[model samples]
Target chain A: MSNGYVFLSIAAMAVTTYLIRMLPMAIFRKKIENRWIKSFLYYVPYVVLSAMTFPAIFTSTGSVLGAASGCAVAIMLAYFDKGLLTVAIGAAAMAFIVQFAGM
Target chain B: MNLKEVKEGIKVGIPIALGYFAVSVAFGVSSVQSGVPFWGATLISLTNLTSAGQKAGVDVMAAGGSIFLIVLTTLIINMRYFLMGVSMSQKVEEKMPMWKRLLIAFGITDEIYAMSMSRSTHLTGSYMAGLIIPPIFGWTGGTLVGSVATGFMPSILAEAMGIALYGMFIAVIVPPSRRNGNVLLGVISAVILSVAFTYAPVLQIFSEWSVIIITVLVSAFMATFFPVKEGADNE
Candidate 1:
């Protein structure tokens, strides 16, 4: 793409991003008093993070074994109360090992 | 908005800025390495204030994804912020003008919102503005400097520093997970769902969007049904 096209693309993306971000607050100014709705919103981040992180663990090489091993490492680390860095590293390490071992 | 509140916002934001400095510098360096123009990456980092989304954007760009795919994927990743902004809107004084609300809302990162909401002090408009100062400067400053100095940092060093972002996430996930059983459930559920989606064959029809949808639905199902009682912050 040309420089102009790239700039336009970025601008378009930026606008979409900004409006998506700002619109909820603009539309829903009232405090969410509904219990179920509030509960749903509270879990939104956890859901978002999970969605983003899940596919990477098992699908790095289009294989299930590697992904499963990687996720097992991550879950173990998380269960043991290892910090984010540890979980990431543990999972990445397991994935790398699985890849190297050709298992 | 009084001068004092701005000052207080700056004071409160300083630590956040310091934290941003290290991580954002890593982000800047990586973006440049991934073939984005330094200015473009710097501007995105300055304006967006979202590290994971930016990283995902860079990865997509590196893989030569189309503009539509890139933006769509990023939008999907960042949808949680909409709810975050809603919660913040509820926290602020009702009559705050739209323009001011828009301006202040730019600073609603995970840390800043938490700190601002947790305070017992009734925040004036200036105080709220002040809260944004350090992080904005810290993030912008880090991106600007790191973009220019990108070539000097070794890749291994940059990779090591990238751990900071993960560390920040750990800090967030751990404390709360320990305090509440529901939070722990949410985290574990996320991990399990993530693994399942990655591995299962018949379910492979799910794209990134499906992963997001399923995770959100599953987590909301868990959290809503098993509601964790949270302590309210008195401001």
Candidate 2:
């Protein structure tokens, strides 16, 4: 909770993220020919996004029902290929409406 | 350093900047709600343009997680950028200098990478600067606005806005999941694992590491069992 710790955490995150983005461009000139590594990297973003969204999402709003309603709206909109802004706003609006109704 | 190419890149980047503004607004609001200071949240956006990585980083930081955990979580969440960097190294013009490469590396988010790779022509420093600068402003500006706006907003509205980031995440993964069975399975597997970590008593202790663990396990399993076809669309 200290400012020092917060600064360190941010610094660590920035350095780690930058290194991941920088190292390959700085050093590697050849393509990664390894199929398995390539596939794993390809799938990582999806897996990470899924893990972060679910369960955590159910608690994002005031109540589980509100969160669920919002989540459903989001999934429905996204399933139809809605843009990120649309899906986000739709989910927030749904949650607001549900919670406002005291459901 | 063609000004014309830079202008073209900026033109192409306009939509991406708009999209990043919306998402980073969500990020700023969510991180502040989770206890990150307004300035800290903005700094995170400035330094790390990535959505998922910054989200996970803020979670760890707000939890009072150790520096090691923060670095590890960010590293794992952003490992995909390594591939992007490699792909970009090959995509940019061959004579691009080291300093330019290093500087441009800082801006290689998923969207930027995808845009650069999709181009029929080789990437240039000026074009990349044009493409990267707007999104940086959009992302950092949105965070600043959201972080400041959180103080004036009602608590209920703030809470509702928390779902915005997750909704964006869903928008990102769901389309791809619908297209690729492997991606769908990877998503489901991660969700199951994440849920188990939250609910199961023994697994509760490791919940802090759940994102990395679930990501690695599910991704590795899918890669081993159902590797994407060699020539398949990576984007």
Candidate 3:
């Protein structure tokens, strides 16, 4: 909750992010070989987000049931290729309904 | 100065800026709800244009994560940018100076990189500037508005907005899983691992670093088994 800590944390995040972006430009002059490495890097985004979403999402709602209900809706909406806002609002509103219904 | 290219770049950047504007609002609301002060959230948005990384960073902070953990998590989540920067480096005009390369790399992002790569010719510094400037503004502006929005919005809606953060994360990971088996497998594996980490009493202690460790293990595991064919970068 301390502003100072949050600021420092954000600064660290910014520097780390900038370095990740800047390092290849600064040092990597050749095409990366090792298809395994390339493939691993390519899949990083999906895996990281996946791991972050699960378990975390289940606990993020007012109740576990609400989170689960909302999650089902999100899955269906996203499977249908709903936009970000649509999926977000859909899940949140559903969670709200579940919570309001005293589930 | 290639004013025409800059204008065109900005024009092309419009969609990206609008996207950033929308996404950053979610970030702002979440960060503030995560215990970040409004100004602190805005600053985070201003300095770190990373969507996933910034969100993850705030999540770590809200969890009372260590500085080292925050830095490492941010670095790992953002490692994709290294590949992006390398590809962008190859796309810039050959004579573009190293300093300019560094400057332009500051704006390297999924949207900016995509917009730049769509160009038939090499990108220039001015165009890169135009490409990033509005998105940056839109992102920061959205955060500014969102961080302060709790003052006006009802708590019920604010709580709903809280769930919206997870909604965004699901939105990002679920769609791709529908089409790509590798993505699907990676996601499914990570989900099972993460759920185990959360629910299993003995495994719960590893929760702090579980995501990062499992991400590496699952990704490398997928890459080894399901390597993408050469010349097709997911597309």
Question: Which is the leading candidate under lDDT?
Answer: 2
* Count of clashing pairs, candidate 1: 5
**DockQ winner, 2 or 3:** 2
Residues A1-103, candidate 1, lDDT per residue (tens digit)?
Answer: 3455446556655665676668765776655455665566566555555555445424433246755676666666776777555565565456556655666
Interface RMSD for candidate 1 relative to the native interface: 5.5
lDDT of 2 by residue, B1-235 (tens): 7999999899978889998998888898999888888899999899989999999998888778888999999999999999889989999999999999999999999889889998999999999999999999999999999998999998788888899999999999889889878789899999999999999999989988999899889999999999988976685
What lDDT score is found at residue B109 in candidate 1?
77
Encode model 3's per-residue lDDT on B1-235: one tens digit a residue.
7898889889988887887786677678778888889999999888888787888888888888999999989888889888888888888888988898888878888778877888999898888888888999988998888889966877666665666767767888888888887789899999999888888999889788877888889988988999988878651
Candidate 1 lDDT by residue in tens digits, B61-151: 6556567766776676566667667777877777878887787777777778778878776555788788887788888788877766777
Global lDDT of each candidate? 0.64, 0.90, 0.83
| Regions more than 4 Å wrong, model 3 | A63-66, A96-103
Best by the DockQ measure: 2
What 10-residue stretch in candidate 3 chain B is worst by lDDT?
A: B154-163
- Tens digits of per-residue lDDT, candidate 2, A1-103, equal 6778878888898999999989999997778889999899889999999999989999998878999999999999999999888999999999988988888
Inter-residue clash pairs, candidate 1: A54-B194, A58-A67, A84-B170, B9-B130, B9-B131
Compared with the true structure, the alpha-carbon lDDT of candidate 3 equals 0.83
Best by TM-score: 2
Chain A of model 2 scored by TM-score: 0.95
Could you tell me which 10 consecutive residues in candidate 2 chain B have the lowest summed lDDT? Answer: B226-235
What does the interface RMSD come to for each candidate? 5.5, 0.9, 1.8
